[model samples]
Target: MATGRAKGRGRGRARGRDETQDERADRMWSELIQEVRVAQTGVQILFGFLLTVVFTARYPQLSQTDRTIYIVTVVLGASATGALIGPVSFHRLVSGRRIKPQAVTWASRLTLAGLLLLLATMTSALLLILRVATHGDYTPWVVVGVVAWYLLCWFVLPLWVRLRHTTID
Candidate 1:
């Protein structure tokens, strides 16, 4: 008769019947996929919209500086869309390779990069739009203020709350 503790069989050093590593990995993967799905849709739409802007009549009317900004924004958006969609490609290539942990790590990094790129794209887009719409001296200041607000809301607050509430064990 084999005991539950047969070497490498039963849960070991686990708090309250710890889940198998595979199970934990599977759960994390599913959560990551869900998050990626949401981000992918948003970036795809934004990138599509950006692609069409160049064909618009107003595009040629933009000042040289605004045109440069528009170009930067479009490139940033394209990069972001690629990064956000990278996980799917990664998963497809590595499926059944017993490398879920590594795949998850890489995917998470890509997602973060995508987010940062998206931030840059949005900021540049806003700056260009505001410059065209307002034509005032304060456009740059307004763009900076809005960018700062986005940084605070998207990154700072979440990090602060996480630091305040989470405990390292």
Candidate 2:
């Protein structure tokens, strides 16, 4: 009878792990914090560099179109920074609320949003830089190729692995 109750509780839970929901949430939260730390550092640095670009001697020499791209890139970087940092703030406000599982879910969503924003920010920054460095027809082509690489490495490969290796049990 005790074995039956244990089996019942384990149903619909992750396979190959004998952890309670709260234990799983704690593990996930730790992993998420590590991941967020890496992304946050990168976006913060990128955003800082973007902030300084306007003060550079080359700023006034930029074409109107290039300036527009720069503005867009800066805004994207700022947004990505915000999104990446949001999970920490969210966790702080909701800590000790007996909602670790919910908090983890929300944090995961924010991290994903942050990653997407970072991708957009990087794409715009690359495009603007290439345009400024070389006024040639190959600029867009180069940007497209780099963006494709990012998409493959950041999104496609991980998703493919998940789909190919994940089991239904």
Candidate 3:
């Protein structure tokens, strides 16, 4: 005997409370997937470019230390790519096990690890490029400056805003 608008309001009220853990996990998983999609594309592209660098003619001219750095950077890039892509594979393998909460938590960890690895890969790549392009003693300083800038932009600013605006419950 309920009207349509009353029934709609009832449904909305049902959804307004704090979500259960399972519901929260499902929502988190969807958000994580979307974030991973964005990161995976960029990491894959960067890794692909890193793989191609060794085959270029200019590679042989690099100093032994530079070669070593390049190798480490490529390995880091590969590792980052794998970590970033892991959540999709993980979700596919365990989609129906009713373990969405655990899956989401693990995927979040993997994504964080991937981001750290990506940061390292980018720093090393920048160092290599700067060294190759300008062979100057100032390269290390410049690299440090840029790394600090990246840290400030990526981590510090976000944390500062969160701390400034968010209230502790």
Candidate 4:
């Protein structure tokens, strides 16, 4: 079995896990969809809450800068929501065209972009809330710390794992 694996690797193997190209694409598509589902649910909930904030009685008391931040946060949330849901629409449109490999690539890109947008939205939301809650200069530092944590969990750690563990081939 080890020798057979070595021979397969030496021949520029097509797919890992013994899957054919189409099967690989299907598996990848499924995994990407699952990831999107988790992200989409969160963003959608956040966006829904954001949309309702403007009508809240407390919204009128926010400072001009806070209002600006709120607007930016809402926009970022909307963008993130769109990006996170884009993969589903992309897949649906391209389903019968037999171009899943390309679709998967596009979906993956969209998912990454969505996650970045989500990070921005969450950071902005946190900053606005902290500013309103604390009414102090320390809010920025606190927000920075939280954002760093998010970056570590969402990006840095994943990248480290990818680089540290993945085969160079």
- For all candidates in order, the CA lDDT equals 0.86, 0.94, 0.89, 0.93
Model 3's alpha-carbon lDDT is 0.89
Q: How many clashes does the backbone of model 3 have?
A: 0
Each prediction's TM-score versus the true structure: 0.86, 0.91, 0.85, 0.91
Lowest lDDT 10-residue stretch of candidate 1: 8-17
lDDT string, candidate 2, 132-156, tens digits: 9999899999999999999999999
Regions of candidate 4 where Cα sits further than 4 Å from its true position: 1-15
Model 2: lDDT of residue 168 = 80
Q: What is the lDDT of residue 39 in candidate 1?
A: 82
Model 3, range 1-169, lDDT digits (tens) per residue? Answer: 8754355355434323366999889889999999889888988998899899999999999999999999999999999999999999999999999999999999999998998888898899999999999999999999999999989987899999999976544
Output the worst ten-in-a-row residue range by lDDT, candidate 4: 7-16
Q: Across residues 9-48, which tens digit of lDDT does each residue of candidate 4 receive?
A: 6556432476678988999999999999999999999999
Best by lDDT: 2
Tens-digit lDDT track of model 1 for 1-169: 7544453445543223245777777777899989889888988898898889899999999999989998999999999999999988999999899998888889889998998998898899888889889999998899899989989987999999999976554
Give the Cα error of residue 141 in candidate 4, in Å.
Answer: 0.7
Clashes of 2: 0
- Where in model 2 is the C-alpha error above 4 Å? 1-14
Distance from true location, Cα of 3 in model 1, Å:
18
